[model samples]
Target: MTLKFLVLSSLALLTNAHMAAFHKAMYCFNGTASGQVNYNNDDPVSPLWMLKKSDYWFHHVNQCDDFPPAPGDFLELPAGSSFTVEVAANRGVTSLSFNGQFATDWGDGGNHPNDYSVANLAGAPLSSSGCIGNPNMHTQNQSMAAGTAFAISYQSDISQVTMDNLAVFTVRYNTPWKRVTSYDVPKDMPACPADGCTCAWVWIPNGCGEPNIYMQGFKCMVTGATSTTPIATPKPPVWCEEDQSTCTQGAKQILIWNQAEGNNIAVSGFDLSGNPKSPAYNSKCGFQDGEGFHALVAIGNVVSDTSPQEHRMTSLVHRPLPPQRLQQLLHHPHLLPPRPHQLLDRLHQLWRHRLLHHPHHLLHHLLHHLLHHT
Candidate 1:
């Protein structure tokens, strides 16, 4: 049997409405490795999709009609409507997105968790100065192959909509966000890391490869996307989940595929619209002239609540390393102790026991150098 859907714009336009949903199909995706699972939950106005680990690397979620940042994803409601948003996390939160941009809020001092942003968009003290945040993207036609649409995954907290004969679009959300009076970036302005966006540490640790991150990052770069394009910031703001910080120009994004490395971290699409992102992170927000469309194994990091909280300028630089290689660093003989002449004793033992290991193991040398030099 075929499924059908019905929509009522006012249903979503209202901050709190008593109206009922028209009728939307329910989609579900469940699968194992070497396959995909992108299921849509029941919701006409804003549907939900469940993506398994395998789906993370591919654009499986886009098949759902509710996916945002895509044209026609939003149905403008008649003026003077109200609605409410709700998000609940069961498993580890993965990502959030709003209107195809990384979810963000001008409500928080214009920054992210670092600042306290008021949730009250209705009471920002209306002034002729106009809205504070007006986000825009500088991506050109040459960067992402041409017309690739990037995901605005970020942390999102559900929001309630309230409008007065005017259509208002919310670009971001926060869960533990405290209410505040004014934010610097303004509600419409998109916020992002000024320069350099790589997720080498976050992605690699989680077993992500360079192929996907480079492809997706550049997809947004070339598109000139905003943090949360007033339509696609994923709600309930959770780590790895779509938020409004990255995806915007000069922004950074690091996707962790459910913590099981190798499950994700690869790009499934080769078309990449037109101008693919150039390999490695570019200093400029977007592609440079002549760079054309490109992709890479680049890595980057952005400031979150943890790790390098004080150093906004600090970023993670990472390269793929095998677990065994890392283990070697953890277990070096020279690191046992420094008895000055202990090396002689170790050598004697090595030869006497017929367990003659080399005195010049790379790991031993590295540890020996660190132990003595430090």
Candidate 2:
């Protein structure tokens, strides 16, 4: 049996009405690590893929019969780099091609090739699905050498005649990120020690082997020592900063302010003079380079409501620490109250422990709490 034979057989089983009912197959790539690779997920048209400075997936979408690019034009990867294929169809994926070689032995009628269904396509795994087997359970390309480019293609059954909701994604960690240390808050803001205030510091990892952002000094609770509610600003539209300020170029400076729903912090960019550029408006304040910052922002008292709300600038940093490492650190016998000499260091450790352990849910909960109360 040949690939053409299986395709024809699969087509024969479907009725004309079924063919016309469904007309699109979505293709995409999954499993790329954060910031390792870049693709335009926003642009449905003219999607681009780049590994470091090199181009990978770039093509035009046309009719299914003549849409995919040539094999030589397919994306290339260095040795040890891999990507997976995701296929979704209104009807079903009926034909697949690799390097211009068609697979024939996909069971009968090519129904569910290699036990892959539409669900699998939507749930694309982080790794490659491996090549399809022929009669001997072997692919046409037995070996993949380093620094090679290859093409992959799939065709939907007659019902799938249109292309929509189709996309491709690729992940490559060819280059590592640069480590960034603490970002200074707006200058006039009080440091750690202040009247009627308790302070804590937290450092989130940026995967570049450095603290992405150093958040120091959170406003301490004034009363209710036994409560567990989070403190928030008096109301939205309140500026977390007493005055809007900018830092010199290369100075990691951030401005955090309160809004009706939640607080937003903007990481300022540098002008040619290396001075931080201020935003025309507070809401518009953000990283000028267009890179996002990721860190855990903790404001107010984690202990109770009615406490003075202290704002922390964090978020959008890439590559965080592992959960297991955080869990182990929590169980250490040395984790204890901070001494007068080590209060600052202890505060930093506490922030790290809380953020790493509850990165996702905690952020969501805090955001929700702030939004609803406002």
Find the candidate with the highest TM-score and give its number.
Answer: 1
Enumerate clash totals for all models, in the order shown: 78, 18
Instruction: Give Cα-based local distance difference scores for all models.
Output: 0.22, 0.23
With candidate 2 superimposed using the best TM-score fit, by how many Å does residue 129's alpha carbon deviate from the native? 14
Q: For residues 1-374, what per-residue lDDT tens digits would candidate 2 score against the true structure? A: 98656644553432211101011122221112233211211111121112211121121121222222222222221212232221111122213322213222221123332334323323322112232221111111212100101111121221221112111111111101111111222211111112222222211111111112211111221221232222222111112222323221111222222112212243345533353432211112212221111111122122222223211211111224365643553444233222221222333453566743555644453444445444
Q: Give the TM-score of candidate 1.
A: 0.20
Q: Which parts of model 1 have CA positions greater than 4 angstroms off?
A: 1-364, 371-374
